[model samples]
Target chain A: MSVTTRRRFAAVALASVAVLAVTTACGDDGDEGGSDGGQITLTVDVFGEQGFGYEKLYEQYMKDHPNIKIEERGKGMGLGDYNTRLTQWMASGAGAGDIVALEEGTIVQFKAQKQNFVNLADHGAASLESNFLPWKWNDGKAGDQILGLGTDVGSMAICYRKDLFEKAGLPTEREAVAAQWPTWDAFIETGKKFQAKSGKVKFVDAATNTFNSILMQTAGNGTGYTYYDKSDQFVLSSNPDVKSAWDLTVKAIEAKLSAGLQTFSDPWATGFKQDQFAIVTCPAWMTGVIKGNAGDAAAGKWDIAKAPGNGGNWGGSFLSVPKQSKHPKEAAELAKFLTTPEAQLEAFKALGNLPSSPKALEDPTLLASKNDYFSNAPAGEIFGAGAKDFKPVYLGPKNQAVRDAVENALRSIEQGQRKPAEAWDDALKAGEAASK
Target chain B: MTTNTADRTRRGRPAHHAQPPRPRKARGNFGTRLDLKTSPYLYVAPFFVIFLIFQLYPLVYTFWVSLHNQPLGGEGEFVGADNFTALMKDEQFWNSVYNTLGIFVVSTIPQLLIGLYLANALNRKLRGRGFFRMTMAVPIITSTAAVAIIFGQLYNRDFGLANWVLGWFGVESIDWRATKWASWIAISTMVDWRWTGYNTLIYLASMQSIPKDLYESAALDGASARRQFWQITVPMLRPTIIFTVIISTIGGLQLFAEPLMFSSGSGNYTGGTLRQYQTVTMYLFENMFTRFNLGYAATVAWALFLLIVIVAFINYLLTRRIGSAK
Candidate 1:
């Protein structure tokens, strides 16, 4: 090569070395819990856009307590990635949260390692128990110890488009719809009727929602099983109630009541907005989803009725102080304050997250409140009625996996990939794997 | 010009003699030899140091962790080989293995064939060649997560452009995520989309380096385009093909992001409606993250390592045999 060419090559090599040096210098140093000034750097982790509304709430809280400042760390949506990120942070001795949010399904998993979280029973939550529904309260309890405090009660109710129901010549009023389908069988029949009327629309979002709502109500428990008779060996597999629920799901798909869109998808959201489905089994938290997605076009066109089955609790969250927390007392105080009837009521007004506290249900504010999002429906009154009746149930450590397994099995049947019996067997297999 | 070049060469030769560059001592000192021996190593040492710290140490630690029952966040027991034993008996693990191998075979074969074809097509003089090369790399440069999301939307049963196009043939909209095989097709489409261009570029590079004389000779021997490809091009490109195959196989088998993101926005991690699209890497991720079973996940990672090693070894042997036989 010529001398100039060689010189150019050498210069390029030096530039490449410089680039590499710059990248290495910029690599993360793995710092945690850095605070600026008097403000505490509380790394509040939530999934998806959950922190958006909570950001507003925190702003209000900061206004009241200007001395205490908070920072938020939002991660991936749903339980899977959320659990993963939380576990990683805690495992690295990063001390994840002073006041951490725990999904209803994740509470048992977190409580399994009690040392990872502070027992909220120590933080005066024991007295607060009487304020919450038994089931919502037990979500944060392990054995006799309370590790988290419930922020919201996810009481299941069927959300139906009033306009769609009216067009179908079915009852558009909440009370009438609630009375029209006291049982799941009648509900499916009503769905058939609704489908016959609306040529383009479906009766429900998917078969799984219909099946799970009934399952949760009839079982009257958190884990979706009433009881295990022998040595308490957890009779989820052969439970007749669960079997019936599974069968009902398959039947719904066969009967064409379901829209066939996977739940929580973009299509499902569109279905909600367009009222493609006549009924949706919405938990209290779903009020936020409905209001956010359904838009003004759906305003005053929807109302909540009793879910086909009796009142069933579906989803709720808890806030807990981990034992590794530097300021456990302050954390516990924060957790306690977050779940208090007053605070929960405020959250309910802002986000449509029903307060788990029963006292919050009886509050004049709850009784008087109306949602402009749901055709100005008195949503609080409707949800509060069911929220009062939620019976507490046991959720074992493997609850999330078990629920997923059952959901998958039911989905197989619903999607016509397997026969009902084969689906049942699949469920058993999945449950076995999950429980192991 | 010739006279000037000659004068420059003469000056360069005489200048070397006139300068008598200062290196006078020839000493047989141990320190000098040590310095000579170590200096070259020191110059190239960073890679080894980085490889040892980041790659080798983590792999060794992962192996150690695999031997125990380490749950997420460090609550575990030392259950020697129990995780491996459990994995052996685990049906989900076996299912994931089947899915991974299935995806690997399904994705890599088409990717290689299409890449080779595209490389051949592009090797010929063509219009907008620069733009075509740039277009080919666009997919590879795009984020995997973003690719998955776009493909997910395209594969949507209700309103996807794919299903809309299929409607031209009077085909029904397939619930891509609802069935196992359909989900595999969707995921394979994603994998093929991202890496086909990359493999094509590799093939094109190798193809460009092949001498024109070989093809000219083949044409002189009454060879057609087809014959030239099979006889001269294929044989000469064997090593590049092998390299591409091995790389593609490793990537295809470790397919996680496409399936994970395709199956995102759902409550379950079955990969698809029936758990049909769940690759082994996804299984490992689920074990570690979703189930909080880190020891089991580590075992899974080790098993995956062994799998890759065995497959790669077999591939290497096959390639060597082909090369040697030729």
Candidate 2:
């Protein structure tokens, strides 16, 4: 209320405003791809509960390239949310990082806009053909351009809790458990046997995870594709692979063998801790997800078994350079370096992401790798032995959307909202609608 | 000191000599006239400029986008109202509209009634009145996302407090996200928890401004407290009630966060397995982000805007007659 006090307050307010303006002005300069003291910052966009496990690699790369600094985005982020954000950035032609990780299911969607990406083959990637598995290297191509480089492949397995197995009076050893079900039909019978003794706990975490595994395995061996063919036609209604997978999943649901949790959802994570389910159809990458969700409390109770079917994959990603990147050449170099056999092995050790490189798969360290979290199960040989021979399946441009549709239909059946026959009809209709 | 005051008062008797002299009028006339004309406009210019850039530009651009075959990467060929025509027959679009209206009715009616009752209780003299009023605002200030997350945990299927409490009542555990009615009730509880306090504050502010003489004369006429409230307070607060009704109408129809966070996982824009509680905003986001149909999403946005306007207008008309029973 006094003149001096008012003057002092006015001066303080002006000073604070001035400070805010200066900081914000500097922030704009720092963020708008500006160089600071000749250093180039390359942002790499990745997605998952844990990213592609490249922290140590980035630090090593920065040490080698003194002028370059590496930053990562989308660690601890879900794939659905990450893909949505990546679509926005690509659509805007700005805000995309120098390098982006494209999952196998989503890469086809981005492949349509091949002009937005820098072809890796043009950046001396053609000579590195022998570094990756043949099918993985081929999956990265759109026409004549190499759109992405192989990072990791998801070798399928069934991760089960040993403590729960003991409780259910089922075989607790990985090999014995795997031998109990050589086919998905046998797998369902074993599930019923476990359900009879387990009392409260069910056999699997969710039907969707099992459904995806069955679909991918069935498609890989039979049609070499699931919802779409090599010609990129929508084949959801006609594909025998889709129907077989659905029928097998419906059988499991009818038996009441599933815990009825949505995969990667909060309840599913809690299901792991609460011991609500005994098994989940886990690919190599999912081991890391299990450890994260199950937490340290569930340290040695889980083990990995060979998946109940022929060799197949569930999740994997590739690294690529966006054409809009300021440092596309450096980004291409980084992408190439990160997919090397050595780098792939590092990621495998950091997270349980099985490498897509045959050389990495053959390494003694990878072949003999025993994960303590899985009660020292042969995590390596189980996922690695068939890694090279696993068939590759072609996913469509709208595969992610259609897969979500099918998954939703499966969940609806598990929730008892729709019957198995009605849900299949819904899945076909939703998949058709989603493909548009 | 008395003599000094007396001398100052004597000097202040002649106001013209005591005050500072005015500047020359003729020389400053043109400058004064220019300031009078331009200064007022300058003071109000910033708001209009911001509104034009942020509001008007998006409104027009959305309409333009709705007419095109826009994909995620960029604009596609203009197809001229094809998106709107498709939306008319789309079952999913209508499903989302049904959900938004269902949630709005379930949440808003109870919220306003409880808010009015709370306002009336607080308007009276009570012990610890300040503490009670302050606590009423605590839910309002808490972020909606945080509230939804906590409530989401409480409603978790296997181990949530809600299910545990249900067990005590000899009832079966409910999967809140599985059914339409269950998801609606769960989301409605979240909406009411967050916004009831806000409505209470608004109602209480207006209640304090009502003239006291009407209540006093009503009591003098041997009217009971309940009768006084119905006869005097309700009629006088018509405009305030209408204002709250219209505001709630706009907010309720545009519901986004609570339902989106209700399922508590990735890709929850679908709201549930069967899209049980997907609001119009969630559908718009799902079309844009999940389905990558930008033109369709733009059409959905425009349609949602029109819906809110229509619903709010209906609310205005209905509430205008609330106190006309006399």
TM-score of each: 0.88, 0.92
Give candidate 2 regions above 4 Å deviation.
A1-37, B1-32
Give DockQ: model 2: 0.49
On residues B189-274, what C-alpha lDDT tens digit does candidate 1 reach at each position? 89999999999999999999999999998899999999888777777899998898789768877888898888655644567656
Query: Which 10-residue window in model 2 chain B sums to the lowest lDDT?
Result: B16-25
Give DockQ: model 1. 0.37
Local distance difference test scores for all models: 0.77, 0.90
For residues B1-326, could you state the per-residue lDDT of candidate 2 as single tens digits? Answer: 99999999888877877778777589798998899999999999999999999999999999999999888775488999899999999999999999999999999999999998898899889899999999999998899879988998889988999999999999899999999999999999999998898888888899899998878888889999888777877787889889999889899999999999888665588889889999999999988987788899999999999999999999988888877978
DockQ of all candidate complexes: 0.37, 0.49
Worst 10 residues of 1 chain A by lDDT: A28-37
lDDT of 2 by residue, A128-165 (tens): 98999888998898988999999999989899999999
lDDT of 1 by residue, A1-436 (tens): 6999999999999999999877544432222232322334444556633442365667765565544666666643655667776877766767587777888777777766777677777777798888677767766777688888888878878888889888988978788988888888888888888888888888888877777677767667434453232233556776777777777777787788888667776667767766677777888788777776777777778787777655777877888777677777666866676677888888887778888887898899998898776766777887888777766555666667677777777777767788878887888887767665
lDDT of 2 at A332: 98
